[model samples]
Target chain A: MTLLHSRRQKEIRKRLEGMRPRLYRVAFAWTHNRSLAEDLTQDTLVKALQAARQLRELESLDAWLFRIMSNCRRDHFRNQVSTENVDNYDLVDERTPETRSSEQQLIQKVRDSVEALPETHRQTLTLVDIEGFSYMETASILEIPVGTVMSRLSRARARLRKLLATQHVDVRGNDSNARLRRIK
Target chain B: MTEMEHITEEMLNAFIDQELADNDMMHVYLAMSKDPDLRDRVCELRANKELLRAAYRQVPAPRKYQRPPGLLPRTAMAAGIMSLGVGALLGWYAHSFSQSDNPPRTVARAYQTFDSKVKVVFHVSRNDAAAFAQILDEAEALVAAEDDKRSNNSVRIVANGDGLFLLSAKASPFKDRIRILSEKYNNLVFAGCSQTQKRLQRERGLSVDLLPQVSTVNSGVFEVLRLQEAGWKYIPI
Candidate 1:
């Protein structure tokens, strides 16, 4: 590599290292798989390096990197693959057994339930729930109107609650009929 | 207004994230006073939002620049062009090549649709039996609710390793509930991990029932990838 090129590469690596955890988290939220998230992060950095010139005068590097991560996630989904794998991403440790197993179960149950959501709803949830992006920011990233982001997030949360409630019934030892009778 | 009619998930998130306008905040506050369910829902969503953010606190960033695979020898081009009085030509070539060498436009376009969907996976290891049961119950409930709300809802539940426990009739904690959920929501699918089941049976003498609703896949990681490809959002449990 030329001396100039080598210098540029070092600068890029420094920037990437600074943003590694955030990028991984965004990709993880997008793909929900550790390995896929890693691959996506790597891909995003490669593309970012190939295109850093376009990012001139950007206010937030975090948002820009997130934008790139978001795009990589979309591309993965567009390819028509199933995301039903057990996330073995060695990054986060499994929940310890000694902790509130039932509550942890509830959390996992909610996570799995959210996993089943439609694509748009899922994206909305991740932006609003996971990344804590504002409605306007989510709208900009999603290329949707702010109103749509609001409506979608509302619906997604409502659906998530209902899902959690239903799953709670099963874990509590009541069948559907029994649970309905109790509710009625 | 009814108590259920107050601040919604969107409104509350906007408020918490400080995205809502003053007028919108007034409306949400008014609704919050009247609608207990809405209030509770907002709280739940807010908590979930916080949890998600905390979980993803350290996401990484992309690299700044990368060198291309190959380039023409600059010395040779410079020598040939100088004799031809083509200093301008050589300079233009070098500039254009450098720009083309790392096309930022393509990268920008590539990520134009950065966050189009949500992706999630359920991780149930062999030891976490209780968690497995709860996840299945949640899956059934989610499916049932979706059945009520939409005419054409699509939800897939892939069970791997101990997750297979939820699908088996003999050991399932919520077998009957799952059946009911499956009956009403045709979109609800239960997938089993072929490798996990094989290992269980051969290594531990545990029998795994790969039921009709529970289709076996190559691997859990591949299943997650497959679902993402099909445009299903993912949340890891």
Candidate 2:
């Protein structure tokens, strides 16, 4: 029995270790900052390890770790203020127009649009669309109903389309006013 | 737009994602066949999903992060093996090498006496091809710097999890490069975990054949622990 228990424990550790990259990737996507993502992943791992005895079903480990990560993300942002100084709108693009490829610009635009989404919608879209989690799995991770997941995902996708379309217009030599309109 | 009234945007989204029930999917398909507008909406939603996926695919995880100290006693030992004497060294070496199935061809030059001994273990856990390449570059640079200093350095790269690609016989693109490195540096060791291999074989039904130069470790985590126990630096790549 002791040997079996030890083997089970080893299995759990290996599984958790294997999940590190995935956990880190999701955390990174949510936070959009490397250090915060690392902190969240580390916290989630430590918390999961400490609470291993509470895990009744090994099948639910993915959801459990994600729940911990979601909570960690919530707590982290709760205490912290946004880094952006909203009034300072004169931030220059470091890459000059000639140097920036069109494909790179489009990718950057899409990235910015996704990051601009509301937290709930962004998380939902990321899990459902990018991470390819089922609605039920996403709901379990976020501690929300499946209905809520569906609604959030739909809204996120719709908003992303609008945001991308608006950006496409702005990218076509539109002035600052057009850019502001798109942002609005 | 009038034709799309029967199918809500959310329903269309669900249909595109295949999240609809079989009956609902059939309904949507029937509706789409009659309605070009509805079909266009579905196509547009799919395009959006594909675009979103493409954009996010560019967002790679950060190269390095601070891995928290493992909480379990065994895990703590695995993550941090400190101040082990010569006795522990010999025991670990023998225990590691004596494992059945695939055994390491040569004992790691870990315990060799040198003027300045620099030991590093690069833990691979992600399938990031670029990151893996970067690790090899860093390893080569370390060797070059150590050589310049006339120091005897040992570098062991342990592959587990998704990083098993570093030693994969069938699918690894880095096999030849790993071979060249081994031939060049007598001090360098490449280790693949038997536990991970067995798990892959059992779960994924993949019988991974490790390259000629690579060695099999009982547990990559434990091998890391043993190396760290004997004054080796631990780095996760």
Candidate 3:
């Protein structure tokens, strides 16, 4: 039993080492700060090492790690509010000037659209739309019923549609290309 | 791109992941046949998701791990050294606070105003000096760019419990930067919990320096609740 436990621990470490880079990236995306993401990743690894014994046999390691990562992020965010005095920093990708401008506009539009959503709707969309969590997984993570997730997601999508439609109308301004783009 | 008229983001996600139930799949197909706008929105959302995923696919893991002290098996000599150092730093910072004229109320008010403008909280629990330093740098950069109009715009850094380690002089990860930021941004306040300090002193003999900008509070959790009551926005970074 001791030998088996030791072997399992070794395997977990190896698997964790392999997944570190990817986990860090997700953390980075969540926090938009390299250092915080790095810290979160390390903390996740350390906790994973400690609580590894509790992971049941049926759970996928990847999913389990992701759950840990999400919890770490939430905890970090909660602590950040209590400990550090700083503003929410958004991650802006740098591309070509034209591309950057367009992307920025799109991102701003999307952010505004998302921000307008109620907290529940926003979380559902963010997890499903932005973070790529499945309906079932998001439900589990959020500790809500699945039907609620679907309903919130549906409302979120409808709100986004309205926002996009409004933006399209404002941008067209009767220009042929703009109008064509809007219609298309 | 025009073919986008037949898909919804939810439908596309479902289709891609093969998660749509039989009834939902039929509904999606029927909806696609009837509504182009739904399809376009889904396409746009799908494209955005793909772009975001591609942009942030690789998360970096730390190459070198610095184990925190609690995790390490302590030698008597190492423990003694840490204890002595902690004692001295704590005494020094406490003395400095006693000598200073800026009362707690003034500091609290300044912090309150900062919270009104742009409240940010930093969470640090790791003993890694480099990592802690980087967190301070990020906070410094953000505070530097903050607007001057918001006099109440404050950053209260509450380091409590294990997080108080960041304030230690010997192991203080962000001492220099914390000092600089606290000075420049009067709105920036660094605080460690008194309880944690006592624990550090009694158990580990480690003393945390409470620099002019850094102060010791009764409890970290209490500080969080107070600032939150004062309407400071919270983020755990």
Candidate 4:
């Protein structure tokens, strides 16, 4: 390979490394496990780098990277046990809390509510609301219709609204259907 | 009031998400001004987006991850190389400088190959929707071909392995089509492999929920074998 080609590949690798944190956040939100999310991020990066030469348009790099992460997560679920054992996790807090602020508590509450969503809705919600992907981009990543993406996003937000309202439903996951706080 | 009542939750969602065009945006904006409940709903939806964005903004740092430093193996590259070798092998296998083995026949002179063998068992072992759709098409044609003759033609689609996905309620895209076809045809059957379902439940912990129209066989492979033994044509997709 030419020196110029080699330099381009190196630049691509650097950008992919930068995507690690974002990928980890989404993976963690979906899996609610630290090691699993980290492993998924690593797997996505490895796959992306192995086939780095196939990246034709530089602008689509973010979408392309995310699409890989989505596939990796799907493969993990397919290989893992059923969805019944999903949110029944141990809330292992890895970080020392500086302050028990109400903001932090609210954030935790929001995370819990998101965890209660169906897998498809959760994915759509995070990709659009959290990751800031366009509706069309999200539809392409999920391999569903744009209409499906909108509907899933709508459902996810509605559920979050109800859960956060604290008026309509006592639907917050109990101690048993617990979660994992942060994966370090 | 009429416009406010006409505005749907989806429209409100679209307005908050900034997915609507300018005209629709203006409509929502005016409606929100006139309706306190609509305004509160919009605020709540927007709050959900903000909370979600904030909650995930700071994630835990990934554990020290480092791969042993080299160019990783690319499956696509390997596949490309393998395809070239397979093409060369195929060319050598079918290579013929002279051609005089079988006599060419016209369409008019073509004869029936499977005479009175109207029963067909489609054997599938992959998670392919297109292949499943094709199987249904071919089965329909065969079943319809002898309707005038009132022959005892039948088709059984035996799914196993990953092919059980074709019959899954949550995953399959053709649930409605499968339901309609099952309702329309009396001699058609959609059989799921029981062993595969059990394996999926046991290994993956998935409670496999198939469509109501599908029935379970002991094993799809064995079912195909049995059907073939009983003079049914074995077709794999």
Top-scoring candidate (lDDT): 2
- Lowest summed lDDT across 10 adjacent residues in model 3 chain B is found at B86-95
Better of 2 and 4 by DockQ: 4
Candidate with maximal TM-score: 2
> What is each candidate's DockQ, to 2 decimals?
0.13, 0.17, 0.09, 0.20
Ten-residue stretch with the least lDDT total in model 1 chain B: B83-92
Candidate 4 lDDT by residue in tens digits, B1-237: 545687877788788878898999999999888888878778767756766887888865544332234735355334423432332222222211012244323111111333553666777777877656756776666665563553457878889889998899888888998898899888888999877887898889877778899998865655664564354655555
Native contacts retained per candidate? 0.30, 0.40, 0.12, 0.42
Report how far off residue B71 is in candidate 2 (Å): 28
The digit string of per-residue lDDT tens for model 3 on A92-165 reads 54446666454355554545555566755765666675467788887876678977777677667667657756
For model 1, the superposed segments whose C-alpha errors exceed 4 Å read A1-13, A80-106, A169-184, B1-13, B34-38, B54-237
Docking class of 1: incorrect
Candidate 3 lDDT by residue in tens digits, B97-145 = 3345654222223333333446655544445555455446545644665
Q: In candidate 3, how many Å is residue B33 off?
A: 2.5
What's model 3's lDDT at A28?
57
Please tell me which predicted candidate would have the highest DockQ against the true structure. 4
Q: Is candidate 2 or candidate 3 better by TM-score?
A: 2
In candidate 4, position A25 carries an lDDT of 90
Q: Residues B70-89, candidate 1: write the lDDT tens digits.
A: 63445533442232222222
Give the TM-score of each candidate. 0.47, 0.53, 0.46, 0.53
lDDT of 3 at A8: 65
Q: Kindly indicate the candidate among 3 and 4 with the higher TM-score.
A: 4
- Model 3: residues with Cα > 4 Å off, grouped in runs: A1-5, A85-132, A155-184, B1-17, B34-38, B58-237
Instruction: Tell me the tens digit of each residue's lDDT in model 4 across A83-177.
Output: 33433344567445666454566667777788888999999999988888888899888888999988888787887777766622222322232
- In model 4, the runs with Cα more than 4 Å from the true position are A2-4, A82-99, A167-184, B65-237
